[model samples]
Target chain A: MPGAEGPVGPRTDGGLGGGQRPRDRRRHILGDVFAVVCGAATLVGVVALAILLFDVVRDGVGQVDLAFLTSFASRFPERAGVKAALAGSVWILGLTALIAFPISVSAAIYLEEYAAQNWITRLIQLNIANLAGVPSIVYGILGLTVFVRALGLERSIISGALTLSLLILPVIIIAAQEAIRAVPDSIRQASYGLGATRWQTVSRQVLPMAMPGILTGTILALSRAVGETAPLIMVGAVGFIAFTPSGLGDQFTVLPLQIFNWISRPQDEFHVLAAAGILVLLALLLSMNAAAILLRNHYQKNRN
Target chain B: MVPSAPDLSFRSGRNRNERIIGAILFLCAALSTLVTVGIVGVLLTQSFAFFRQVSVVEFLTSTQWTPLFQDKNFGILPLAAGSFLIAGGAAIIALPTGLLAAVYLSEYAAHRTRRILKPLLEILAGIPTVVYGYFALTFITPILRSIWPETDVFNAASGAIVVGVMIIPTVASLSEDALSAVPDTLRQGAYGLGATKLEVSTRVVIPGALSGILASFILAISRAIGETMAVTIAAGNLPNLTLNPMESIQTMTAYIVQASLGDTPQGSLAHQTLYAVGLTLFLITLSMNVVSQWILGRFREEYE
Candidate 1:
C-alpha cells in the first residue's frame, strides 16, 4: 500500500529515502518503456505501408505508359497491359453508380424523411444492415444464378455490374442515410412553413445541402466496387483477354482480377506485373477516397 | 384578369410535375428493396437445387474432395476444415495486434501521432487483397520457409499471416472508433480516484466500449472468412484436412474459384457441390453479421 501510494504521487525529490524511490523510478521507467514500445509498433505499421506503396508505385508506374493504358493483355508479359481491365472497371463503375446512386439515395430519403416508424420501415432497415454484411462471394452466387444463368447474360459485364451494384448498395444507402440525417430539421421546417410541398423542400433545399455528403458516400462505395475481386471472379471474370470489351455483354476483367491472374502464375516477372497492377488499382482507390474526403470536408465546413 | 388565370394554370402544372417526381423517388426506394429480395431469392433457389442433387451427409462428411477427378469424392469437410483453420489462424494474429494497436492509438498516442497513424493504417486497407496475395506468396512465404523448412511454398501459414495483415486496418479502425467513444468523464473519475492511465483505459474505457469492440472483432472474422484472393493465391488448391498450418490447404472460396475456372461441366454433381459449399459459407458469414448487428444494437452505450 505504501509503495503504491508513493508511485501514484509525483516524484519531487530524486530519492525519497531509498527503496521506495527506486521502485517508483522503476515504475516510471517501465511506463516510459511501454509507451516507447507502443509507439514503435505503430511506427512499424506505418513503415510497412510505406514499403508496400513504394514497391507498388515503383513497379506499376513503369508499366503505366501510354501503351500500357491503351493496349490489351497479351500472351507475353512484355505486351500485357491493363487496357481491357481498365475499360471493364470503368464500365462497371459507371453502371454500378448509375444503378446504385438513385436507388440508395431514394431509400435513404424515404427512411430518414418520409417513412413512418413502423414495422415495415424497421424490416427494411434490418434487411439493409444484414445485406451490407453478406459476403461479396454470396452476391456473386446470386448474380451467377439470377443474372448470368437465369437471365442468360452469361459472363458479361452487365451481370458483373449488377452484382457489384448489389454489393455496394447497402454501403451507399447507409452513407446516404447518415448524410440525410445530418441535415438540420430547421431547414425542413422553414420550407414547410413557406407552403412548399415535402418534395419541393427535399429537392430544392435538402438535396442541394446534402449533395456533398451524398456524393462522398457514392464515391466511397464506388471505390470499394473498384477493388472488389471476389464477386467479379464468382460472376466469371476472364483470366486472360486480348481485346477490350466492346459491350456489356462481352467478357471482361477488372484491375483486381488482372492482378490476381498475374500473381497466381509461377513466373517471377508476373509478380512484378502484379505489383504494378496493384499500384494502378491503388491510385484509382486513393483518388476516389480523396474525392470522398474532400466532399465530406466541404459539407462539414458548410454546416459549421 | 386573363394574365392571372394563365399564371395560375402554369403553377398547377408545376405542382403536377412535383407529384410525378415524388412518385419516381418512391419507385426508386422500392427498386432497392426489390434488389435485396432478388439476391436472396436467387441464391436460395440455386442452393436448393444443389442440395437436391447431393445428400447433405455426403456433402458435409466426406474427407476427400476430388470433384474433377475420375474417382470423384464429394466430401466438403476438408475444404471447410481448411477454411476454418486458416481463418482461425488469421484471427489469432489479427485480434491481438489490431486490439493492441487500437488501445495504444486511442489511449496513449499524442494527437499528432494518431493523425499520422490512423491514415497510415488505412493505407494497409487500401492495398488490394490481391496485392497482399502476391506479397504473401513472394515475400512472407519465403521468410516463413526459411524459419520452417518443411513449410510448403503454398501453405496456410503464409496465407493466414497475410490475411491477418489485410484485416488489421479494419479491426484497428473500428476498435479505435469504439475506444474513442468512451466518455472522458470516466477517465477523469478514474484519475480522481488515483487510478493510473493504464488502469483507467484497461478497466473503464475498454469495458465501456466492449460491445463495439466485440462487434469489430466479429466483423473482422467475417471479413477473414469471406476473403478469397489472398488465400487462393497463397494457399495451394489442395483441400487437405490437416491441422498443420505449414501445409497446402483450400478454402470454400478457393474451391468455388477452382471449380469455376476449370471445366467442371455445368449441371454435374461437382458443380452442384460448389453451390453447396457456397451456401455454407454464406450461412456462416450471414449469421456472424446478424450477431454483430444484434450486439451493436443491444449493447451500444448512448451518451448525451
Candidate 2:
C-alpha cells in the first residue's frame, strides 16, 4: 500500500494547485483512499492464490510419492493412488493434441489466409466464438450423445478425447488465427514474389513463424482439457477404474475426476486425498504454463 | 530475342495440388460449423424427447426439481435460481474488485510492477476450477461456517467466493486491456487540467472503456454461471429454491454432472433431463457470449 500513491511528480504548485481549500484536502484524501482500496483489491487475488496453494500443499504434500504414482486407486484412503487417473490424463492430452492441433491450425490458416470477407466467413468466426463460450458440461452432453451412444464408443478414452478436442478446438482456432494473422504479410509477399503458391508460402514461411504462438495456445488449451472434469464425467470417466487404460476403447478416469470423487466422499482422509490430487493436477498445469511462457518469451525476444 | 521463350508451362500438377490443399483446409475450417450444428442437434433432439414426457408448463413452472424421487417434479426454477445466485454473488464480488484492480494496473502501477503483477493474476486464472472447488470446500467453507454457524457444509457462498476468485483474472486482464486502450492523451489532458489521478481514472479512463469493461463483466458472469466442477463440488446437490446463500443449492451444470454420474438407462426420462438442462444452460450462456462479443466488437471498432 505504500506505493499506492504511485510515483508522485515534484509538487508543481507547492503540493496542490489549491492547497488552502478544504475541498482540495478532501479530494486528495479521497484520491489516497481510492488508491489504497484499489491496491487492496489487487492484493486480494494474489493473497487468495497464495492461500489456496498453501492449503493444498499442507494437506496433500505428504501423500505424493512414487508409490502414489504407480498404484491404482483404492477404497482405503492411504492406498488410493493416482496412477489410473494420471495415465488417463496423459492419454487424453496426447490424443486431444493429435486430434485437435492440425485441424485447428488448418482452420486458422483457411480463415486467416484463404477466406474472403463474406458472411459465411463471418458466421464461421461467430460460431467459433460461441463454441468457445459453451459450458464444458454441454460439450460433455454432446460427447455422451454423439460418441458414447450414437457411435458406440462406450465410456472409452477415445470418446473423452474427442469431446475435449471439440471443446478446445475453438480456443486453438482463435489463437492460431491470431498467430497466423500476426505473421507479417511481407513474408507472404516475398514468398509469392518467388513464384511460390499460396499453400507453399503458408506451409514454408507463415507456419514456421507462427509455430511458437500456436504451440503456446495449444499447450494452454490442452492444460485446460486436463483440468476439465464435467465434460469427462458426462463422457463417462468413472471415478473408480481399477486398472489403467490399455487402449483407446477402455473406460478411463482423469486426475480431476479422481479428485472430485474423493471430495464427494464424506470421509476426512478422502478430502486430503483430493487435495493431493489437486497438487498433482496443479503441477501438471504449472509445467504446461511455464512452457507456454517460455515459448512466448522466446518469440518476443526474437521479434525484438 | 527471349531465348526461345522460356518453358513456362501451366504446371497443372502444382495447381491441382494447391487446389486440393485449399479444399482440405476449407473443410477443416468448416468443421467448427459442424461442431456447432452437432451440439444444437443433440441438445434439441434429446430435449424434445424430454419435453414430450414432461410438459413445458410443468418443467418451467414447477419449483422443485426432484426427478429422481418417486413424486417427480420437473420444474427447472430451483436449478436456474441456484445458477443465478452463484453467478450473481460471484459478479458482486468480482466486478468492483476486478475493475479497481484494472484501474490500478493501468493507471497507478509502474511498468515493472504491472509486468510482475499481471502474470501473477494470470496464474490465478490458469488454475483449474476443480482446485478452486477443493479450496472452496476445504478452506472457504470452514471460514464461512466459523462466522456463520448456520452455513451448510456445501453452501452457495463458498462456491461463489471461489468462483469469483477464479474469474478475477478474467475481469482484471480484460478490463486492463480496455483501460489501457483509452488513448494516453485523454489522461494527459485531464492531468493538464489539474485533475487528480482518481478523478482521471474514474471520470476519464473508465467512461472511455465502459463498453469493454461491461463486456468483460458479462463474460465473467457467464463463466460463473457455466462453471461446473467448483460449484458442483462446493454447492451441494439439493435443488432448493431459496435466496439464502448459507443453504446448499444445485446449479443447472451441477444437475448435468449429477445426472451423468448416475447411470440412467438410455431413453429414460432422467437421462433426457440432462439434455434439457444442458440446452437451457447452453442458451443462456450463448446469448450472454454473443452480447459480450457484440460489445467487444463495437468497442474495438470505436477505437479503430
Candidate 3:
C-alpha cells in the first residue's frame, strides 16, 4: 500500500511559467494522487501474475512425477492423475490445429492476396473481426448442434476439436492475415519477375515468408484452445474418465475440465490437486507461448 | 472468377493448378460465412422451439433461473443478473487497472522495461481461464475470506478479480496502442506549455485516444461477459436475482454448460434453453463487437 504512491507522483513539480498557479498546491496533490492511482493499477497485473505463478508452482510441484502424468482419474486425491485428460487434450489440440490451420491460412492468403477492395470482401473482413469476439461458449452450442447431434459425432474428440477450431479460427485468420500482409510487396513483384504463376508466388514466395508468423499465430491460437474449458464442457468433455481416448471418435476430457472437476470437489485435497493440474496446464501454455515468442522474434530479425 | 491482375501468371504452365488453388482458397475464405450462418441458424431454430414451449413472458420476467430444477422456472433475468454482477465487477477492476497499465506502458516505460513488461503481460494474457479459476477457488477466495468472513468461496468477487486480471492485458495492450498512437506532437505541445509528464499523459494522450480507449473498454467488457470457465468455477451455479457480488449465481454461459454437460435429451426443454442462452450471449457480444468496430473505425479515421 505504501508503494501505491509510486515513484512518479509529481514529487518534483517545476514552477509553471516561473510562477505557481493560484491552485498550485491542489493541482500538485491531484496530479500526484492521479499518477499514484494509475501506477498502482498498473502494478496489479504484474503482481497478480507473479503471485499466480508462485502459488501454483509451490502447491503443485509435488505432483509432477511420471506417475501423475501416466495415471488417470481416481477417487483418491493422491491417486488421481492427468493421463486421460492429457491424452485427450493432445488429441484435441492436434485435430483442432489440423482442421483450423489450412483453412485459416488459405483464407488469409485469399483475403490478403486475391480479394479486391469490394463490399463482399469488406463484409468478410468485418465478419472475421466479429467472429473473433464471439463468445467461445456460443461456439460450444454450434458444435453441440452441428457436430454432436446434427452431424452425429457424439461426445467425441473430433467434435470438441472442431468446435474449438471454429472458436479460434477468427483469431488465427486475423493473425495470419496480418502476417501475410506484412510481406513486402517488392517480394511479390520479384517472384512475378521470375515468371511465377499466382499460385507459385503465393505458395512459394508469400507462404515461405509468412510461415514463421503463421506458425506463431497458430501455436498461440492452439495454446488458447488448450486452456479453454467452457466450449469443451458444452461440447461434452467428460469430467472424469477411466481410460484415455484411442481415436477421435472416443469420448474425452481435456486438462482444463479435469482441473475444473478437481476444484469443484468438496475436499481440500482436491483443491490441491487442482493446483497441480493448473501447474501442468501452465507448463503446456508457457511452452507454446515461448515457442511463439521465439518464432515471432526470429521473423522480426529476418525482416530487419 | 479469375483475379484481373495477372502479373504473376505471365508464364503459367498448366494453369490448372492455379485455378484449383484459387478455387480452394475462395471456398476457404467462404467458410467464415458458413460458420456465421451455422451459429445464427442453430441459435434461432432452438430459440424458436423454446419460445413455442415456454411463454416469452415467463422466460423474460421471472427472477429465477431453474430450467433444470424440478419446478423448471425458465426466467432469464437471474442468469443475466449473475452475468452482469461478475462482468460489472470485472469492468470495475479491469477498466481502471487496464487503462492505467496502458497509460504507463505507452507514456512511461523505457525500452528495456517495455520489452520485459509487455511480454510478461502477454504471458498473463496467455494463461488459461481454467487456471485462473483454480487460483480464484484455491487462493483468491481464501485471501478474501480472511479479509471478510462473509465472503463465500463461490462468490463473484473472486471470479471478478481473477477475470479482471485476465482482461488487464486486453485493456492495457489495446488502449496502450491507442494512447501511443496519439501523435507525439500533442504531448510535445502540452510539454511546451510547461505541463508535467502526468498532465501531458493524463490529459493529452488519454483524451486524444479516447475513442480507441473506449473501444478497448467495450471489447474488454464483452470479453468479460462471454468468459465462462473462471466465472463458472468462482461464481457458483445458483441463479437468484441479486446485485451482490458475494452471492452464488449462475451466468448464461454457465447455464449452457450445466444444461449440456449432463446428457440432456437432444429435444428436451433443457437442451433448447442452451440455444436460447447461446442466442442471448451471441446477441450481447455481437452488439458489443459492432460498437467496438464502429469506435475503432472512428478512432482510425480521426488519426489517419
Candidate 4:
C-alpha cells in the first residue's frame, strides 16, 4: 500500500522521462541485494542450529539406550550411563520448582497489587532487574560461600537447588509479574464490590487468571536451572559420584555436569558419550519448553 | 451510607487476615533484595580475604594467573583479555547478522514466514548452553581444525563462533521487537517519500529503534562475556594473555569452572580467588546491564 504515488504524470515532454535514471536503478539494485543479504543473515541461525542438531544426533543417537540411561558414569564411554546425573537433575528441578514457585509468584503478586508507586518501589524493581542480569557463575560463588560454607549445607542437592532458585528467582518474578498485570483491574473491582478482601480478590480471581502464564514461565525457568552447571560446580558438585542422590542432603550430579566432564576428556569416545548426554539434556529442555508453549497456546486460544 | 458504616467492624477478622497475607507476600518480594545483598556480602568478604593474601596491585598488574600452580601469579589480565577476545569476536559475528536478521524480520518477511522463523529462533535460543558447548567442542572445533590446520584442541575462535551463534537468537529477537515497536506509519511515510524498502528500514526504522537495538547489543555482549559452558568447553584452561583466537585461552568464567572442578580447601587463598574473579565479572556485567537498561529508559520514543 505504500509507494503508491503514481508514475510521473505521463512524460508530457517525453524523452524516456520515467525510465532513464541510472542512479535510481542502481539504488533499487542495491536495495534488492541488501534484502537478499538480510534473508541470508536470518538463515545463519537456522543453519547453525541444523548443523549442531545433526552433529549431535549423528554422534550420540547410537548411544542412547536403556543401559546408557541406567548405569552410573564410568571411565569407559561404552559402560558409562546417566543414572546418577538424571536422578540428580530430577531432584534439583523438583526442589528448585518447589522453593522458587511460591516465592516468585508471591513476589509478583506483591509487586503488582500491593507495592506503592514510590522511589523505594523503583529501587527494588531496579535491583530485581540487576539481579536478573547478574551472571550465573557469580551466583555460583555466592552459593559456595553462603550456602555451602556459611550455612554448612555442604555440596548437596538442597544447596544446589537453593542456589539455582536464587539464580532464577528474578526471571520467574518478572514473568509472573507480567502475567499478573495482564489480569484486568475490573476483576479486582468486582471482587471488592462483592465484599471480598484484597487477599481474597487476588487469591480467588487474579491468581487463577494468571496461573497459566506463571506456570509457563516457571517451567521455562526450571528448564534453565536444569541446564545450569557452573553454579552447581561451584557449590561442590564436581565429585565423581557413582550413585544417584538418595536424599536432598546427598551429593549430586546433573546431566550438563556429566556432559561437561565427558567433553573435557581427550578420548573421542568420551566425546561421544558427551554427545549422548547432550541428547538427553536437550530432550529434557525441549520437552519442558514445548509443554510451556503448549500451555500458553491453549490458554490463549481459550481466551480468544 | 450510614447503614453500611454501622457494620464496618464486622469485617475486622478478614481485614486482619488480609494484613497477615500481605506481610507474607511482601517478605517474599523482599527476598530478591536479600539475595542481592547476600551476593554482595559474600563477594566482598571473600575478595577482601583474597586481597589480604595477594595485593590489589599484583591482582591488577601481574601478567600471570597461575594461582593453582606452585608459581602463583594473581594478575587478572589474562582472564580478562580472554573474555574480551571472545566477546569481541562474538560481537563481530552476532551484531551484523543479528541486526540484518532483525531488519528482514521487521521489514521484509511475510506474516507466515515471521511466524515460522520466530519460533525457530526461540528454539535456538532455548537450547542449553552446555549443548552449545558440546557443539563448539565437537563440531566447530573439528571444522576449524580442518580449515586452519593450526587451530588448537581448544581455541577462542571456536568458542567465539559458537557463543556468537548462541547469542544470535537473542540479538535477533530483541532487535526485532524494537524494530517492530517502531510505528507502521513511519514506514508508510518513508515509502511515500519514494524510499526503497532497504533504505527505509536502514534510514528510518533502525534509527527510530536505535536505543533498543543498542541495548540488545550490549546485553548480547554481556551474555557473551559471562557465557560459561560453551567457552569453557571450546576455549581451554590455559590463561594466555594474547589476543590470538587460534590459541587456547581461559576466560574468567572458565577459571571459576576450572577452580571449582579442582579440590581446594575452604578459606584457602586458591579458593578465595574464585570470588575475586567472580566479583570482577559481576561488576562488569552489572554495569553493562545497568547502562543497557538506562539507555532503554532514557531514550525510548513513546508513540501516541
Which ten contiguous residues of candidate 2 chain B have the minimum total lDDT? B1-10
For candidate 3, write residues B64-147 as lDDT tens digits: 777777988888999888888888999998998899888878887778878888888888898888888888888888888899
Count steric clashes of candidate 1: 1
lDDT of 2 by residue, B51-156 (tens): 9889999988999999998999999999999999999899999999999999999988989988889989978988888899989999999999999999999999
Error of 1 at A294 (Å): 4.7
* Highest-lDDT candidate: 2
| C-alpha lDDT score of every prediction, in listed order | 0.81, 0.91, 0.86, 0.89
> Which of the predicted structures, 1 or 4, would earn the higher DockQ when compared with the native?
4
Better of 1 and 3 by DockQ: 3
- Give the Å shift of residue A82 in candidate 1: 1.8
The candidate with the higher lDDT, 1 or 2, is: 2
- Poorest 10 consecutive residues of model 3 chain B by lDDT? B1-10
- TM, chain A, every candidate: 0.87, 0.92, 0.89, 0.92
**Candidate that beats the other on lDDT, 2 or 4, i.e. the better one:** 2
- Can you write out model 2's per-residue Cα lDDT over A251-293, one digit (the tens) per residue? 9999999999999999999998998898889988888888888
- Over the stretch B90-185, how does candidate 1's per-residue lDDT look in tens digits? 889778778778888988887897888897887788676788887788778889999999999899999998888888887888888889988877
- The order by descending TM-score is 2, 4, 3, 1
Pitting candidate 1 against candidate 2, the one with the higher TM-score is 2
Q: Estimate each model's TM-score.
A: 0.90, 0.95, 0.93, 0.95
Error of 4 at B148 (Å): 1.7
